[model samples]
Target: MRQKDNGGHVRQEDGNVNNSPPPTLPNLPSRRTPNFPSDPLQILRPDSSESRRAQLSEPSRGRKGASLAAVAMTKPQQQSPPSTTATTTTSPPPPPSTPPPASSSSSLAKLPLRLHSLASSSRSLLAALRRSPVTTLVAAFFLLALFMYGEDVRTLAELSIDDYLYPDADFYNVSALPPLLLPPPTCDLSRGRWVFDNTSLPAYREKECTFLTKQVSCLANGRPDDLWQYWRWQPNNCSLPTFDARRFMEKMRGKRMMFVGDSLNRNQWESLVCLVQPILSKGRKKIVKRGSFNIFYAKEYRATLEFYWAPFLVESNSDNPNFHHIDQRIISPERIESHAKNWKDVDYLIFNTYIWWMNNEDIKVRRPNSTSWSEHDEMPRIETYGRVFKTWSTWLEQNVDPASTSVFFMTISPLHNSPAQWGNPNGIKCVKETLPVLNYTKPLDLNHDMRMYDLVAKVAKNMKNVPVSLIDITRMSDYRKDAHTSLYSIRQGKLLTPEQKADPQKYADCIHWCLPGVPDVWNQILYTRILSKSSPPSPHPPLPPQ
Candidate 1:
């Protein structure tokens, strides 16, 4: 018969215990049992009733066997009882002396539970991202675009304000900028003196140009004093800006500018061409003469500087540039359509007609119907000048578009035929005059008919539609008595003879100015006027699409 010990180990009725090892138990912290106090003498004693009760009440058979084996090993074998005295009653084994078997199995079971919890959290996160894909894509694209185009967006914003204020200045990197707050240029450009500075002499050489006339080529005709070329015009209240040839050419590019009037206008036209020619390369310019029109074309700039010979500013028989006699001057005062046809399309027109109208002879006027000339001596010089200018002004009002064209009338260039006009009793003419008259505090009395100037001013002022600016060059030119061609002028491509040269008072050309001289200053003033009145450049072309 088999009997169970209190430690759950099986024992024979003969009192011999079976010593087999117990089965392994699953590791679980909650199933672990507390360790009891160990005793060295417990193995020799019989099991108590409480131990027997615990062995019988153990839940799993495998766990009960493991616990019983641990207890048997820790307890020593008890002294065997006599067979006759051992009545059928079996003794229970003592409690375990080692740690409980559940302790090791409990720790092993905790790892799998922790691993299951982490996998459950990962699945929940993946489900949330899959629900909304469009929002995720839009956010990603916005960040990428900002990274690629950030600089370009910033540059466009900065240029928007800069381009509004300075429209044309975007292309060139100019070194100096004009003052933001500057007083408007006044009409008194002629109120200053001629200052002597060698550095400012001769804007261009006379021999370099093929269009230069011998009548005005004082340097080419061998004048003694070179100091006349160095004098610069300075206004009283403000300083005159220096002429920049490159800048002027840039302004005149693709434009047609004409000087319309007498040979005096030709003098100024040549002066302007020479002033700007040095900045252009060779073969870049050409001169074309067609009828009464003389054109200087700068090829690179596409600009034409032209002179049309209309000395009286009307249709006259003296319009023949080559062979017309000065005494036979007759004008059709009502008819200017012939000359205005060529002048209408020009961008800038500088009209001058003064010295040619100063003749005291009986003037001849051609009426529309009458074939015969009508002589008028009773009409004063001012009335005749006014009638002709009225015809010109009427033509301007009818034809010229003031928005597209700029019109200027150069005042009468003064003549220095009589030195007595400047209080010089001994000096009769402009000959032998080396310097400007400095001591004469009073204005020099001139033979130039001032009535013509008054007529021009009146016509320009009265015009309501057409705008005309009068470039008053008279007073400034009056002080330049030393700047004339004088006895040094070339007559018909020939130098004056010794006899003619001896009497300079008779042969002196006190009318036209020497080249690289006073006319250059006039052009400088013209340049200033052009700059002051000019509109800003057009807007920049639109940028290409990205």
Candidate 2:
């Protein structure tokens, strides 16, 4: 086990600069092997300077199809193959702060779609057709088929099919099925359980309207701009009617709240800090990192907000050169609990690990025992992961004292990469398409992509008082479609082009939400859930300086 200083931090090796550099922590390259675009918003372009009245006032094509076709005709030409050198983008640092617009969800929903068309020469197609029309058509057909298949796959996957199909699928070999958590004994108190303003908050800036559920708002206090006062200014009712931050701190003061996972989890951590920072004086709330974990402590409350980067949460370092070339495994279950052995002292624990596991090489996605990737056999067969998590769950059941400690497992954050949903399939990740939480009653199976759901549910059933709560952020995020950082992260200097500044969606981030962005909603949900039971210590009534 790594040794820790009395302060609860582990010291790092001197020469390990890149891996152990000071905390605090993008770019799309053109050439340089055509790297992935860091800014997801730039992929789609919606006209901002022009007025909707002007376009409609002087209508060119009577039919919507004709107008769309005309817009397509004016699309920019894709850059040709580079002669030798490559091109890349360096996204600028984030802006200091900004004011959000005042618009209700309904008005935001009526926004128009941002459309872009690529101009390909007929000659280019003819030459390729002459060479292999059949091949080109066949490839196109295959792609179309795949998308069609994906749609069906997504539909089937989203449904509540866990019971019927996997009746005997013991999430953990030790556990059977878990009971269904009905929406809440009834709708009144149920609605009050975790309800925020009961309306969505607007995006920090204007972005595209595509892929967004027309009227959804980003959850209030979910963004930096929305909650900066609460964090710094120490405002009351920061989590009013639903969550009461002061009450939460009173309950959790001197206790701990640990969010374990990858960077996405960190995003939520930062959001939470921003939400609560204002409660304390400058330097009173400090963030310090020592070894494998990082902690943010509010001295007034004696609460430490900690983060442990255990994407896999189990030890799986690269023993092989190939694995090292990809990602080094870091945890071993046998040795895993050692890092978090102190977790027993924690008052609350929240965990997540999904996107990191999506990569093919990370773990043996397709087992050696399986011949091919089939829809039927596509159930994640990470035998080793299954065993490790099972052990982890069993560990939690044994370790945590339900009376004092609460545990939560956040759902997989969704990825919006498709063209039909976001309009800028080639350009953005999850940029400006901010909308409200969708109200679809459609049952979508979260099995295929989120293989951990079943395992977690099964684990929950077996654990006695832990009452593993599911922070279902997936379905809600899937609909936001536009609320990612996308291309904004790639802009290099503080200053940006008029086009860049005007197009908030193009410049915003995709992979992770901004400080006052979407993740704050997750933290708010967490706050509501944890505080409902007990009141945490307040940061007020300042204690002597540490």
Candidate 3:
């Protein structure tokens, strides 16, 4: 019979000379068993140093037999059979009395040298561990880390592009989870971290969207890195739903959605068009410029996404989205009908106006029938801003039907005008920033942005007729110092020149964000409101009714 010694190598034992049948053998691994990584030591126990050394030793008594393990796993597809002629011998197989066959001798001869070298290396490793424990530990750690990283790379290599863009599409049970478009009543949508996930982010690609204006197309304007496109917003307790453009369009089927306010609203309006455009058929979609509105129409669904240029949400001298960069700005706070007239019949209305009002401490207020700068009164910005919003609110209360039209007031979109605010003291503006700022020692509830945030919420709460949903994005926006268009955007209707990009302090366009970046996330929040048909809660408490 064939038997294994303490070292686990096979040797022939004595048997009946005349009547013995072919010796019974232990189960041996064959060509059918593929050993991955094809290393001889893989079969040994990882924690047993003695067994490792023993496996590398020659069989006892110079039996002419060997372990056959290394040769069994040498080739993945085909390996020559180990010599089995000794198994049928009548007496115990012994060392050859004369010179053996060349085939058998050469194969067995080279194995001992290989085993001797391995044994010597194993002893040296043990001696090193004993001599310098710390050095040996560090080397072992590095080797282990290398092995794990190689495995991760191998796993990632197997994924396809489809897997990258739609990973978790089927992971959530849609019917069981909260409304795909609505935040839970208690869920704090504003409290979240920006998660790095290359698989399913960016919401859309910069090159794919035909609706983008050059002002927000940072990637096309000589900016280099594309890593900014791979972030997903993860709330502290809940997750935003996976966006389904088809479903959103179906819900807004036969409806008109208008975004009314400043260029910031127009930025958001452009994002919505890009997101919903891919799902529309080529000839079925078209955009038109009509008066103060840029309208995107989905013919099959009969849906219109309209943007109206109303920068203070009331009559302002800068109301013209094009050619609104006047040296002096003026507003007629009470005269909002020229702007609100277009918004009265819309099914969904989203409004935002802040960055334009922040340029000067005092604003020029022109009363009715006053067009000249000579007839304007310079008032503190807060009072003028407050009265302008009040005019917007009063129009909402008396002009539109609450049951038919939904109103949403977007809070301030914070600015990254200073690069020093984020750790770059030598930097001039939002350039070369690829990640959102995350480590705030305290929550962002005490800045100038929050002051505007409180005022917007307080105004919305005071209204009794209109159920206005305040999309408070300011707190979350404070952390995104890296997402602005900076010098990639246009100034005075002209794309920034090389000289302007070089001088960020004078021409860095920090007022707006890059498309396929922050604005995409903003629309996801907007889509949530249209999805659930329920008002998303505001982060601030409403003031007491007087």
Candidate 4:
């Protein structure tokens, strides 16, 4: 029998129909498949509608088939409908056995789920916070404190003596320890003798140091008392810790220490330099002089030791280094800023001004607004001293930060110009004395001018904020009558003539103490005071076992 083909072509309806395939339909170019292959396998494949229909209808597929179906569900197929069919048919797809690979649409579909999960977590956290608000605030505060003080806490855990030395009760309130247990600094320690020991002779040789004033260089001027070179200050009650120059430099690293006062302070300043300079290597030290200010820099430590010559400790006409007249000294009692402006930002300040005030019988003070000088005649020296100290104290209270600065007031350095004051009628001055007054029992009578000692002590005691230490070198220094420069002091770097040297009473320098002498002991006391004020780390408590 003959049968008509779907394309209206003649075809025999026999078993050979399977062997000879029907003619292929013309393939219109599709957007998805622009270059469709004309291969027989591609043409023989089932249409998308039929394939999806088979997958939907067959419910008992094996594991392999299910996996294949899952892959097919994930990858969408592209199709082009035949022109003969007016409408295309599509079967509903089966539910995916496994989720599709991540894509923009898939990610968007999961966004709502993620948002719901986040909202649930946030609600739980809020509920927890509401239940324990105090706990939450405390935890936050603890975290903040830890962030701020973490390093300081760690440092306190591992403190060493090399790092710092603890302060005593004199500097601050040490209420933790009982009064009996505290080691108070004794006055007997300050009143000891200078014993002969070649091992600890001169800190720096006078011949080598160029910083020494010609007036104080007794060793260079051929003094016969080599015993003075070997003599060391020995405190009666407590031993003074030998000054460690390296340790001192380390402590003073990147700091500015200044001596603000008269040439007496300059004497102590030179002594400190001699004490520390022996440790400095070549090219490690430098000296800079500008007008009345002299600065010595230790390059390795970045430390500066400066001296500003302000004899009155306030503004004075005698402030000039070269033009300061001994008898014509003029002071402006309130005008301190002209001198104090340079003293700002100092880490340590050592001040002395008692000797200059004693030069004139009447103080020539310039009034605040007037050009004429007013004489403060026979004004009890203590009252005059008190006014000046009040001005200084006011300046300190206003300008100095107690947390950053350490201040010291050296007590009056006694002068031995009159040997009659110390009960030696035969000797006119300190010219021929070879040894210190060893067994002096009577306290020498220092009159009203020396009453400034009690005033300074009272002022320091009364101060509540800034603690100024009074270095009382007077009593101990009074015993060292043999330590002065005397006739050995140079006059303009020239040896005294026989005529001038004969008059030891006139040419004797009983004012300044000799270097490698009593000034060293003064510096030692200064060192101890400095160490006593430093708030070093305490011993940490034992940690509890985990």
lDDT leader: 1
TM-score of every model? 0.64, 0.48, 0.64, 0.62
Window of ten residues with lowest summed lDDT in model 3: 4-13
- Relative to the true structure, candidate 2 has a C-alpha RMSD (angstroms) of 27.4
**Tens-digit lDDT track for model 4 on 1-546?**
222111111111111111221122233122121121221111111113343334322433333233333433453332322334234347565333223354323323344555566799978876787789896797679879989976544433222110111111021223342332212565455566657678877666776665666667788766778565556777766676666566566556656689988877888887888788766543345455556776776644556787888888988767766554566667877889988977766778899888877865567777668765553334444566788899998888888877888788998888876667777878877888877766667666533265677888888888768778888788778777888887776654466677888988777777776777788878877876776566332222211100
Q: Rank the candidates by lDDT, best first.
A: 1, 3, 4, 2
> What lDDT tens digits, residue by residue, belong to model 2 across residues 428-496?
444444442334345333233545667766776776656687776765455444455444333332323
Ranking by TM-score: 1, 3, 4, 2
Spell out the clash pairs found in candidate 4: none
In angstroms, the error of model 4 at 272 is 0.4
**Cα RMSD for predicted model 4:** 35.1
> How well does model 3 score by local distance difference test?
0.65
Off by over 4 Å in 4: 1-188, 372-380, 446-448, 492-495, 535-546
Q: What shift in Å separates residue 50 of candidate 4 from its native position after superposition?
A: 99
Candidate models: Cα lDDT each: 0.66, 0.46, 0.65, 0.62
Q: Give the TM-score (vs. native) of candidate 2.
A: 0.48
Please list the residue runs of candidate 2 whose C-alpha ends up more than 4 Å from where it truly belongs after superposition: 1-242, 318-335, 361-382, 421-428, 431-448, 490-509, 534-546
